[model samples]
Target chain A: MARRSSLASRIFPFVFGLVVGAGVLYFFLPGPPQGGKVQTAQQPGAKPQPGQQGPAQPAGSTLAEVRARGYIQCGVSTGLPGFSNPDDKGNWTGIDVDFCRAVAAAVFGDASKVKYRPLNAKDRFTALQSGEVDLLSRNTTWTMSRDTSLGFDFAGVIYYDGQGFLVKKASGITSAAQLNGATICTQTGTTTELNLADYFRGQNMSYKVLPFEKNEEALSAYDNGRCDAYTTDASGLHAQRLILKTPDDHIVLPEVISKEPLGPLVRQGDPQWEDIVRWTLFALIDAEELGVTSANVDQQMTSASPEVRRLLGTEGKFGEPLGLSNGWAADALRAVGNYGEMFERNVGTKTPLGIPRGLNALWRNGGVMYAPPIR
Target chain B: MRWSWTDPRMRALVWQVAALAATLVTLWYFAAMAHQNLARQHIATGFGFLDNTAGFGVVQTLIPYSEESSYGRAFLVGLCNTLLVAALGTVFAVMLGFVVGVARLSTNWLIARLATVYVETLRNIPLLLQLFFWYFAILQPLPGPRDSLTLLPGIFLSNRGIVMPAVETTPSTAAFVLCLLTAIAAAIFIGRWAKARKLRTGESFPTLIVNAVIIIGLPGLVWLIASAAFALAPPVMGKFNFEGGWRVLPEFLALLLGLTLYTAAFIAEIVRAGIQSVGRGQTEAAHALGLSSGQTLRLVTVPQALRVIVPPLTSQILNLIKNSSLAVAIGYPDLVSVFAGTVLNQTGQAIEVIAITMAVYLIISLAISFAMNLYNARVAIVGR
Candidate 1:
């Protein structure tokens, strides 16, 4: 009798626990699992629930969510001087920051209604996919894998860039060909690392690479002579050189390597949100081609040209299809102006970066930056 | 049958069952929720990504690797780097810890005070700051490759790394190594035979000198015979940097130095407490028997102190290994930096990468714990 009681005591809790656990799980179960196409976030303001059934469509869920939250969540670089950097007064400035402000103006009609989440190169894409940010305006390269398999959509190219090298002037190395058997430092988890590998292989030269997780670390290593050269985008090399200890000592090599079309990105499964971001970039370029500046935007609203009139939302109601007011383009233009004004204010020849508008210029002006018409 | 309501045994059983059921339900609900969320994101969940090509380069690799290698190869390289630092750090920390700990209880006042200062300063400051100081402040200020600090005819030190001469092996190099191993085995056998003989009889032999002569003489004779074919390859300064030699990276040196110094501080305290646990009577008794201070420590006190020291020392070694993940901050390419940071970013498979990384650390820690526990059992007191 004693042995039987002891055996029961040893096994009773586990058996009882299993039965109770099953009952609790049954009570909390969602509806029956479906085996057809997976449901996407298409219904505006609909929270994610299991067993949801609907055809995947762009129902403006992201826009409705942003409206309910009263602000746009934007992901930018940690601190790239001319791209997306914070000033001494905690106010963000540069081309990427101004682009987010333009989006906020189009959505809420208030350019100040935006919050910035500073992310590193490694964490930028994940932050956008996880719904931590509505738009990632950091200088991210658009690749096929990221746009499809990684579940993201590239809006449009904001900067036409290419990989370049920065070497010290005293080294007397004038060209990229002289960098054979050199030790190069670059930021990790970036296209710059892969491109460095590809370029060296194509040249059939031996070199070593040191990949740091941040830009400043890589630059510091190069400055301290731990590396013979530093590599990144051509514009990045120019902007980062200003912060080095001896900016005049280093010179950017003339050879351009892989093409890097840097742009903003959003998560997949939301066509409406993707269209809004894509056309916002188009509106900036279109406004520039039509001779409309932020200062003259109010006057352009009454312009005689049909193209300018359509873009300023006077001749057509194009904003309604994107779930915004008819004055959306005018508000966006008033907040950050045209693409040319943005480039000149942040990184053009007049600014510290002094990068020329070579490939980023409009197609009609012998550059490849062309946007579809508003009509 | 009827049950008694006021029986203490029955009341305790009812409470236990209820608590068990509640805990199980909570765990089940969380696992279900995670499953649902992952399915909704449509992110692939599995270890299949390990076979894909890793298209990036690592600063240092222990084995053969390239951009065309698989992600699995990258993970192994990271693991090797981590193990190298952790193993070397543990050996150096224990040696330093014992020396400082013994100095703390010394008869000299200045030595004891300096030892006290070292322990207090290191243990109070954070390990991450010390790593940054070692990497950026001290090492980064060194000269470039053009003007390297020449330590010897064949060795150079600079901000890039420490370049040293490497041995160019000949056909007879394997024969020389075999002779060396034979000498080591002979020395161990002779030492054991000498001890057994001393126990049987009351006479001692010159065992130390004999073993030293055999170990050195046998390897020296073999090397002399192969000198005609052997060569030493010294580093040559190239236009960019040093060429054709073995180099030790500054990142590895800084991380090893920081980890050893920080862990040795805590270990010094544990050793001090252990030595103090041995009673003063043991030393006094050894002195009355005409044992010197050195003999008293090695022969009488340390064996007893080992009973207390081994357990806490095990935990300190474990802490050092886990702390090596901070190598990412200094760019050492340890398991966390290359696998969890870079591979996770490239593959975007957070769940699998994180799970595998955690399992690796856990397994390493468990293996260390198992070995230490066995050692602890052997040294433990045997009650009558």
Candidate 2:
């Protein structure tokens, strides 16, 4: 009995020590409660006191925080050919990438002052809202719920996209309506899933949704005939079709179901920062409309047009209103030429994506990319 | 007055108190921190979201569910999937483990070598790699439904899923249940009779043969009667899938196959160790008593070996349960995938989602440990 008592006594402290250690570890471990709320309160649209000069910082103040950090943390996709993929030389290019450069140029006057963080569709919002990225310029669609509920502000639409269905030509399916009772492959954690459901339900047609966790898996399943059709953003369908064993084997259906406004996003609250980002994009569009390509931007900066002079920082103090340097817009324009230049250089017919500028053209060309006057 | 610090009882009490205090303090700190942080982030810290609509659909739910269901329902679906995979994996692993364990001790050189090779090769590779190989290399290569690989009549294997003819029972399933109960009762009666006859007459009866006959024959008889009483429904092949058959999704098959093969290797090692732990003296004593090889193993070796096996085997079972979380990697919609990934995204409540997920896993682990301990106590040695 004495020995047993002794053994128990000896074992007691050891057990106690383990419990204490686990408790301490748990205490130190990072959890959502501690940091998440504070960050949300700091978001752009977060309420500020009367004396407070500007909007609250979202979780991470993307604008001021990026400046303090000395490098713009830009979120890009892992690899989407002709979008945000890495080049043969290990440099990131494409339209989505140039937007990141444009943001960097506006902030630091050097487009190269950026650190790209690759994220998946599911993780992109969290990365931005968590302040891991200064800007999210991935091929993400802008929607109402994402805008209000997710606590992020979207800069204007850069690409006008629509959802489309792709099926094998051999299946003799010409339209999406013909796909009743079909098995459709779609990627989970995106608007595509809801779009597919709404479209089918709206048409009073029944179909089976075979959702895959990744786009590649969905594509592979569709290619292997596991599903009768694949649905995604029309642009993504075109990009993925290029990699198929037989590029011509599948045909994208003509029916476009939903409007997908793709653009860059920043966490909400910092109105000053939001304006800076919004105007940077507009500057690119306005530059292209005024025929101010990167090669001629230097020359146009000295020209007499009051709108150009104001935009080029030769006439007004628009930059001061946003608390930026006078030449910020000019810096952004010089970084990636303009919106039209970015499109032609990245996903144009000259490139692999070969996307045409349909609804993405300037207002002068009868498209919807109209920017407010610089004055 | 003469008590020293080395006194056992004193030491044990001191240790317990110290441990208790430390645990309390640590819990207090984390609770404080979590409260503070959640308050700061404007994130709600509660399980209220469980009442909110899930707004997403699960691919393979055993229960009927829809997008309009609550988050609580989604959690149930995910938990069901996890249990489904773990149960199926455990069943297959035990059968394969026993075969391999026996083969490792086989007299035939080729069989022994083959089993040894399988154990070594599978044991070394990571489970994630095995999962990928099965999902990508094996399942993805299967032909589509238009040209499915038919294994047998009413059974087909394709890239989509494994389809088999299911026994479609109606309200008359009660008849089948009665048949099953009759077989079990017959088997028990035969076993008891065999035991009584052996004890009274000092003569053994073939209990195994009698039990088998009662179980199988009674079940067969009842099945016939049940079928006659009720119309038997047959499976028919439908477009894309079998209409009246049970279908196992490709994700489930991959996860189940991967987990079973991966865990069986570890189980084989455990079984080998247990058998080796039995003393040679016991076997020699059995031989001296003129006991046959099978009798020595069944009567002498196994009983001793089990004592050595049960404790470690308990831990391995717990490990298998915990490792089932890896189902997320292959998109099997286990607790983590559905609750943490999908629900978190839909709700925008990361803190609530993560906390719930952690709590669920802890509860599962604790339940397994409790069950294992109860079994352990029953099998433990009693002392005077």
Candidate 2 lDDT over residue span B38-110, tens digit each: 4343334456678987766577788887766899998998888888887777778867876787678778999
DockQ, per-model, please? Answer: 0.30, 0.27
**Candidate 2 displacement at residue B288 in angstroms:** 2.1
Error of 1 at A232 (Å): 1.3
Q: Over the stretch A321-347, how does candidate 2's per-residue lDDT look in tens digits?
A: 776788888898898988899999988
Worst 10 residues of 1 chain B by lDDT: B34-43
Worst 10 residues of 2 chain B by lDDT: B36-45
Off by over 4 Å in 2: A1-46, A49-61, B1-45, B170-172, B202-244
Model 2 clashing-pair count:
21
Every model's TM-score: 0.90, 0.88
Model 1 C-alpha lDDT per residue in residues A1-375, reported as the tens digit of each score: 123353465355446544544543442245422333434544543433423523332357789999999999999999998899998998999898989998999888888999999998888877987889999999988987676556678999999999999999999999999999999988877888878888988898878887777788888888988899999999999999999998999999999998999998887766778888888899999999999999999988899999999998999899998999888889999999999999999999999999999999999888888999999
Residue-level lDDT for B232 in candidate 2: 34
